[model samples]
Target: MSWLVDKDWWMKTYRGLIVKSMKLSFEMDQQATDLLSKMLDGRGNVIEFDEMKNLFKEYNESIVFGCGPSLLPDLDFLLESGNLRNKLLISADGATSVLINHDIIPHIVVTDLDGLIADIAWASLKGSVIVIHAHGDNIERIERFVPMFKGRLIGSTQVEPRPHVYNFGGFTDGDRGVFLSRTLGILRITLAGFDLNGEPYSCPGKLVPFNKRIKKKKLEVAKTLLKELVSKGVGFFNVRGEPYVL
Candidate 1:
């Protein structure tokens, strides 16, 4: 039988496995929260929900770009597609550099401050809404980079969201871009540069590092989440070579 025929069973099984691993994840998130608290310490502005809603009021379609190596070769096609003009362009952190290099600035960027901070900050300065994520593993990064931003900022957390921080339900930066678009009520979302089967691209040395095995696992989780979103009526299209449908 096809896996889709037993979707409920698979989802339950995945949830059970993830639940067993959530403790460690939660502990790390708590640690990151503590660090973020220290970093913000009365500084920096968080975008309110009303403000975010207002920003996306006119947008209905979004194109979310991931930073898998395959993204580099596909950039030309994406730029030439001509469909980008009217759609809200959302870039996963690392993909910001690529987009910037191609003179295509995203309307929003989802990052863990793990990619090139300079690129992300530049994009923010150019009017891209920066959705920065806080997690235990990137505490030092948040401390170092958060203060460097001078444009629109939105903070997200994996745990409970508060006044300045929000949680939209995603694990990595790439998937977070989708979550952000979905949360904003985008009617359609097209994904590009998402090669879940391959290794994650490496960023600058000072940026957050990448581990192949960990990234692969994260991609699996992302795929599962994307599938869940599909089951819930969210419209998703994959522009990469083969369409990745739920």
Candidate 2:
């Protein structure tokens, strides 16, 4: 994904130490990447880079929905705005549930195969292209779910780019969606359901078992990277009344 930002720039922007802090290893990340590549061999379901560009070619804007406290309110605001007509809907991992409950299947869903297997699978079945992120923690999950998606998915990673896994310049799913939009040449990106500075990242309480402190740090890393993008002139917007200022 050297379209919007080059791989070298991404390498210089984010650090592998951050990924390592999450207990994700380079070997494991590569394992996941190679697994996805092997599974995709001779398959016709590839979600190619050109396909991504085409997916946003006619759209005037794209919206990334995060699994934050303000997600519902932001969704309501977006729905009330009456602007769902030409916007590409991208949802972060757990945010897929929110969109699905609203009867709105996102155009693309970014996930690490952490939780909500049923929801992610359901979304894929409903014509939503899934962008699966791989790392040390999700190799098993990737093995379990990649075959099931049958080509309706794209692979991503934070460590490095392999034949299958493309390193988009974001750590978390939400910001990664933003990176995807920017890389695909989407002009305007509105972020909903992002609570960047809200209440200390308590949302992932019981769903996924990970250290909260480390997770909070990852969120901060995401925020910093996003601010950098904003400073660099990427069109990013936060929903009204949300804690996030981007």
Candidate 3:
């Protein structure tokens, strides 16, 4: 249900989409991937795939937090409703800092090494299992930060699977975290702060520097990939905005 299934899923479902549609550079992704493997093999404390799977058993349910506008409000609702007990908190990229700032250190964090490095580092030192995603844009960061990260490191990539880096059937950091959860055998996943359509009127843009249209396109891709995952008999419940639509 893990290694074999994951490899098949990556090839069958995601690889073509990444290469043909998204037009991602396979060469660059592989370069970043090889760097990750080198770090894992030589200088890093890379968590073996099986050992990483065992860590997911600490909680069967996980709430994946994105940097959408509803993120904080949803966390507040979960706290007020008293339904957050025993939930494995997984922060996607920048959400790690938000969660830590709120005094709730997530049990795991997923990132591409683009967020505030110091915040991610703090969470790592405090025992969060950091799921590091390697891709074209962050090869430098992979070399710079990986050696300094303190806890268990789970390596991820989209190009291909390796002894250390893995393909878990997701594209963006947020959905990639969800895919990782499901691939590791966790069936229940919740989404928070995921504004698929666009940023709300009251909220600043998620990635303000990028063109809004491009950001919207990326969000739609994430939503589509997540829906595809759900269509395959996985359970994903949205905690904010409209329920998931296929």
Highest-lDDT candidate: 3
Query: Predictions ranked by TM-score, top down?
Result: 2, 3, 1
TM-score, candidate 1, is: 0.84
Ten contiguous residues minimizing lDDT sum, candidate 3? 200-209
What would the TM-scores of all predictions be? 0.84, 0.89, 0.88
Model 1 local distance difference test score: 0.73
**Model 3, range 1-246, lDDT digits (tens) per residue?**
134345666666555665565666888998998888778875456677788767767788778888877888988887777667787788888888788887888888888887777888899989888889899878988888898797788788886767677777678788888887787677778887777766632222132254565566567668778887777777777664334553
Model 1 stretches with alpha carbons more than 4 Å out = 1-23, 34-45, 199-206, 240-243
lDDT of 2 by residue, 32-87 (tens): 77776676656677677677768668776788988878888889988897766678
The residue-level lDDT of candidate 3 at 39 comes to 85
Report the C-alpha lDDT of model 1 over 1-246, residue by residue, as the tens digit: 011113455345334644454433666775776666555546555566568879878988888898876677667776677667678898998899989998988988999887888888899889888887887678778878888887778777766454466667677788878877888888588888888766655644336456766666778878877887787777877664344654
Clashing pairs in 2: 45-151
- Every candidate's CA RMSD: 5.9, 2.6, 3.2
Model 2 regions lying over 4 Å from their true place: 1-4, 20-24, 202-207, 241-246
| 1 or 3, greater by lDDT | 3
